[model samples]
Target: MQDMSASLEQSKPADSPRDGHLKRTLENRHIQLISIGGAIGTGLFMGSGKVIALSGTSILLVYAILGFFVFFVMRAMGELLLSDLRFKSFADIVAHYLGPRAGFVLSWSYWLSWSVAVVGDVVVVAGFFQYWYADVPAWIPAFLTLFVLLGLNMLAVRIFGEVEFWFGIIKIVAIVLLIITAAVMIATAYVSPNGVVASLANVVAPGAVLPHGISGFFAGFQIAVFSFAGTELIGTTAAEAKNPHRSLPKAINTIPLRILLFYILALVCIISVVSWAEVPANRSPFVELFLLAGFPAAAGMLNFVVLTSAASSANSGVYSGCRMLFGLAERRNAPAIFARLSALSVPVYSLLFSGVCMLTGLTLLFIIPEVMTVFTLISTISAILVIFTWSMILAAYLAYRKRNPAAHQASTFKLPGGVPMAVTSLVFLGFVLVLLALEPDTRMALCVMPLWFVFLLLAYRRRTA
Candidate 1:
């Protein structure tokens, strides 16, 4: 461990190129919105219907439980990142304390996580575009969106931040409007086209919350967990964030509130307005809330919001994947070309590589007749990989606490509950993994995820050799 630490220390000075470093151009507002963007994903907009269908009003409990643990995971991550400003990414912290091989595997695994997620986002966005123009080929919108996002990302880091900021705003406004509209409808006792009245009683009636029993409640975790996939994305922005000490903690601390407002509260409003039993299992409940409230154009507006939400997620994927590649190259885990920065301080090659890889999703659209099936499979795989990523962050935190007791003691932004909380969070994550197997859709991804780790192990050995 001492030798590994020593090597990591030695590599830092050599890795630092005054001109090549990623620019810390991300302001507090950018980090704040990025955090918001990460918390609200396409899964919430698109997949929550399935969660509601399976779990009924118990979906709230599912998100609450997951959000509680996820907050601690972020705290652990925030504490770790703030512990050492030199830690560019969680992979750096993992390599520093858990050894390089673990770091290498995690770096690549995280990249693949975002890669798979972006592909899924691309597929979803194409489907969204076709909602308005049914005759246009799916691949056209898929590739065009990627082309636009890639160009924006290639220009500069702040440009990417600006794009996400507005995307986050759109999502926030849409959810807020939905919540307010639902609240008004519930108060006014507005009735739907099917004669179902909007009322808070709809959400809290006897046995209504768990209509399908505990097993159905358990099934909700599969998709609800996927909705929180990008919550840890804040950790990846440490290298490029301006004044992370202030912005990161503020961002991390508000996670619970975000969950309460954007997830739990929003969901409650939805279930109240359109009883979970009546909510469409395959479509967005958000759009349903607006449409049922007499907004005829709500479909188009919500469709655009979801389209940008998916685009925002894919944009994040592109940004994170390239940055992870850059970090890996800096550590000599990947080809050095990825380490090279453009004049704008962007990792041009890495960005292009990730974008090109995402384009492969277009082919899946052509080959697969059922887009939702492809989305379900890809999203489940991404969720599995995300579990691996969050687990590593917790593990790295434990290692950091053990290896550097003084650092933990001195941290200005410490994770609440420290070591015990980290362990509990890990257990909760494991439980979620167990839940994934309760359904065949997620079970297939769970069974297949091990192959990724095995391949990573082989690659690690060959790289070391």
Candidate 2:
């Protein structure tokens, strides 16, 4: 491990084009926490209610199943990053093992997904402000916050890391406190304002783990998969980390712990506090669960935490998007200007570009009073695109394994089940795409994806031309 770390540190040239723009104050611990922070967004705080409404108590099963695939997907990514330290990010891997065309698609597809996701998060931030001031327009907070986030990104990557560190800390503390509260309630058989006691039966009653039937059960997986979309941001940070070899694995290894704490334990606690029947779809189920537990203050507190989560996510999008632009420019994949860095060691062009994309939140305000509807579609599409990116990671892993089976054997963080596990994860992602196509609301994302690919192809062709 020490040798690997040293190798990673020395592998890239001091003035290498790939390393030219990335800020290097990000350390191992920051990378680890940011990975968790990036993955655990405000969605769990706000959107889990929809899954409960669709599948009832059986939502837990969906989380477990989807999380299963997501973990191995991360493992595949870890393997690929370790395969060659010169692979600055996923785009590099896609271009190398696959073809430049595949790399181009993966790069822009992820860029679009995260870019749109930033817009969705901006809308959520707008709503977060309205909780305190009813008359304030959502777009005001959304666009204003985007400006603030852009400034932070431009200041330095370490500033972004510091921000995400605190952001992750808040959500982690909230989940810990929530779990403790739920445990106490379960012990006392605490009854809610809605007249339900905290107990195990809540997760098994009525729906009995498949209440939505097999279809609803699968739909819940779609929701769970979306929740896990940004979990792999650690991989992207590898190039910027002071110790990518150690930090990257340490960050990726937290998958099981995060899934257990955030997804499994949190879901169990929510359902245990309030029956699945009481979980609301239109409103945040997290807020409803706390309110049912008779803590009006809890609703406001969770609201604050989720608001931070959204900010953290949009903040992360801005940072990664900038780094991606830097990578693209180094390879001449994006415009030359985007590859430039500031004296502060920040990717200013990427930050400004991402901020501009996020400013589209104003359009949402103009078109829809209830932006959540559109936000959900866009986020789900983001999740679907993430699946494609994860699939590419697995494909890259397969290629790496075939080329250097010994490297796979020698790695410290090998996927436990090897190729079969990677294959299973890929198949599950494909199934998720199928699920996206089947649902009328999500089907729009499926159609949008092909169009997105075509646009990326044209962009790549134009770039090469």
Candidate 3:
């Protein structure tokens, strides 16, 4: 009877195959938009001001350098996924090469990373609402976003894909328009109320290139690494991608170009329009620069875009967290409940779990109104956890290469400098962790980060033993 019961449970279908977790509903266009959308987060829209203040003109170089390194990391990841169609994302690949123990760590850590990130994005959404109405509490928007996303995710993965597609489209259009506006102002040599004009001096001028010198440049590197945090989400969704082998490569190739045009060019335009020293760390210089340049309408429009960008991050946060949880359950690392799916083929349990966690943002706003610090702390911790996952991928790649030299020799999507580039990328990430500790405020992340791992280790020991 016990054996029969076990057989029945094993055969039970939690979700209909048709309605189940995204089965290639994401086409090439959907994949590209999602990749672009994930890459362009609230960080670029909101956090760029602080990064600019920290590194001055050198921040651009920091992004460029970091972008260069992460590109190789993505290439290595892409090569692994293409090597085996069964490999969904980093977690699956880690599990395959390392062990179930490592996979659990990667999966849970990744889920927590995205879950924590939702807090930051949710808080930002609340703040954006405050700009329109002073009395409205932050929790309202946070809670509303949480419920809205919950409903959307529970329906179908395709719905979530479509929403993110448009959310990302809004961001792309806004940035393109901002670039055009900056270009026109530069060509005309128009002076802003701040008495700055577009010129090459913005990048090369003294106190601009290295405002805080090497220290500031390093500081910017840490911040820029955090900004590039979600670029790997493309890999996460690869299993669900309709044609991952083709779509994955296309998405990965776009990263460096995106960084060059969106990140590098955008910053150059902003700094040229306003001095690096004058760019406020607390305020979004993008919006302020538009206002200063006698384009109040564009400023207001950009504010709307920033608001949408925050929402976009929160939306993707739920999508990513739920999927990560589903992946974990498939590997037996998470509760069976997380593996359960609705008639629509969605992992409803994991979806609701993330939604409820995001709703905590509302509780936070009421309990601790000065929640930006909490947001920053969570964001830093999430970034640290992601570095762990990335390292695991490189480690897996090293092992995979050792095991299959012939396959590596035949692969087309190979890293340029081979294993050395992978090792150097790992080392650079470690260096960023040290830099995070150097900052008094960010040091809190180091303190909280270990507690998470300790908890994971305990769980792993209990499960294994």
**Tens digit of per-residue lDDT, candidate 1, span 1-465:** 465457656544234343278889999999999999988987898889988999999999999999999999999999999987888888898888788888999999999989888888877788778878988887788878888888888888999899999999999998888888888998999999878899989888777789899999999987887799888889999999999999999999999999999999999998888888889886778877887788869868998898999899889988998999888888888877788788899988888888777777557877884657878888898888899899999999999898889889999999999999999999999988898998988899899889889999999999888
For residues 1-465, write the lDDT of model 3, one tens digit per residue. Answer: 243234223323345343344466788888898888878887787778888988898888888888898888888888888876666677777777677678888888888888877777777777667767768877787777767767887877788788889988898898888888888888888887867877757778877888777877777765576678788888888877888878999999999999998899888888888878888776667787788888788888888888888888877878888988887776667776887778767888888887777666457677677545556666687778878877888888887788767768878788778899889989987887788876776787787788888899899999879
Best by TM-score: 1
Steric overlap count per candidate: 0, 0, 3
Best by lDDT: 1
TM accuracy, model 2: 0.93
lDDT of each: 0.87, 0.77, 0.79
Q: How would you encode candidate 2's per-residue C-alpha lDDT over 1-465 as one tens digit per residue? A: 444344334323235343464656898768977998877885676668888887777777777788778778888888788777767787777677676678768887777767877887777887777777879887788888788888788777787788899999998998888888888988899988778888977787765567668777667755676677788788788878898888887887778888889878988888888778887776666666667778889878987887888889888887877777666666667766667678877767767876676676447677777857867777787888888889998898887677668778888778779888888888888988888765677777778778877888888888768
Residue pairs that clash (backbone atoms under 3 angstroms), model 2: none
Which residue pairs collide, candidate 3? 19-344, 19-345, 20-345
Of the pair 1 and 2, which is ahead by lDDT?
1
Ranking by lDDT: 1, 3, 2
